[model samples]
Target: MSGPDRVAGRTALVTGAGNGLGRAIAHALSAAGARVILVGRTLGKLEAVAAELGGDSRVAACDTSQPAEVDELRAVLSDEDVSILVNNAGIAGPVRELVDVEPAEWDEVFAVNVRGVYLMCRAFLPAMIARGGGDVINVASVSGKRPLARRTPYTASKMAVLGLTITLAHEVGEHGVLVNCLSPGPVAGPRMARNFRLEAERTGVTSAEAERAFVSRAALPRMVTEEEVGAAAVAMLRMSGLTGADIDLSAGMIGR
Candidate 1:
């Protein structure tokens, strides 16, 4: 299970890379010999991940959801010829019915999950196109397709991500940019724990019980791991011509 890492020539910018799934993918890209730039809002966390990677890895504490910050970060990366962009930044909007959702909360979630992707693509895709080819991997979710109940904002945001992936793929195919989405099911991480807690509050069940219910939807008896999601992301990095496609690393979750 070993071969030469071919990503040495590539430079990858991973957003939300301070922890969780973002951190795992950053590590994977680095392990595969790519120069990785870790981007997140938390300086301490991003620094910690960068130190662990222990290469020429760089860190930029930038909140992807903020247009000004995204622009500043883009300027910081202007010198580097970024060849791969992994839009992994996201937030879980409040778990509530569509009518009960707050406008502020909805904007908060979309600003990060949806608008951030748009800004990043706009900021970096031109350089990628000019350089000949690149990868724009958007981290989406199963709820994007199956529409998880009581999570209107999160679901809608991801559906937008899915649609964006497809349309961007078509728009940039002539420019050698491959746009695709990675839809992961419940993964064992802090985000999943938070989701369980939210579900418990919504359903009057224990977090443990809610977690089991979530996993039961998957074909497997358990949720997937962060490393598994990282592997899926790395796989997407190596493939081409998969524009407008979604690779669901959902452990076969039954679609509703």
Candidate 2:
């Protein structure tokens, strides 16, 4: 469990495994020989990723935000000993002035980004502790480290994740569970494009301009690649010395 396959012989449960960073993490872990459980909302999308993974990897469709769904998901995984848990499922809520955003939309954002991660931990973390040492990597964002204009809900939810990761790390480290957060900046994907479009509409600037602004804080400003995010995640899973800390993969983005 400490070589090229750093997570070898461990079972990893990754949420939002349908695409983007989540997919990249799943691929990286599976390539390293971890038994991967792909959990997401869409079975079809999970199936597609499962096919791409094809090994001992599996698909379990669940909405991380729903209590009942999370319980069922835990039951589905009860038989398999999960040694790694990656909470990557999240949603970018409506981009608008805080006052302009609907309360429901704001709540939904927290439901998925905050409560969802909470539920997953609630279900799987104790089992890992009871069995002995394990790892939990929570995917956060650079926005959580600073304020982002017009993306209040997304920013707030990510901040909550940071806090949760830190507090949980403190609580679980004694139990041999290491919890950490990986805060990536502007990971290139359809999601980033959508965020740019919304920011453009908010600022009356072009989406292209919004993209530049999104990475303005990066000393070496650029879009973060999916492969880089994947590698960072794998690194986190491998590192045993760090806990309750956020590993920033934001291309030197200056945080406020």
Please report the candidate that would top lDDT against the real structure: 2
lDDT of 2 by residue, 1-256 (tens): 2345458888999999999989999998888778899999999999999999998799999999999999999998889989899999998888778989999999999999999999999999889889878899999998887778778999999999999999999998888898999999778889889888877887799999999987776877887888898889888887877799898888888444
Cα deviation in Å at residue 61, candidate 2?
0.7
Q: Residue-wise lDDT of candidate 1 within 65-141, one digit each (tens)? A: 87898889889888998988999999988887899988999999999999999999989999989987888999999
Candidate 2 runs further than 4 Å off:
1-5
- Could you tell me the lDDT of residue 158 within candidate 2? 96
At residue 123, give the lDDT of candidate 1: 90
Model 1 score (lDDT) = 0.87
Clashes of each: 0, 0
lDDT of all the models against the reference?
0.87, 0.89
Q: Local error of candidate 2 at 91, Å?
A: 0.2
**Candidate 2 colliding pairs, count:** 0
**Candidate 2: worst 10 consecutive residues by lDDT?**
1-10
Hey, what RMSD does candidate 1 come out at? Answer: 2.6
Give candidate 2's error at residue 184 in angstroms. 0.7
The candidate that wins on TM-score is 2
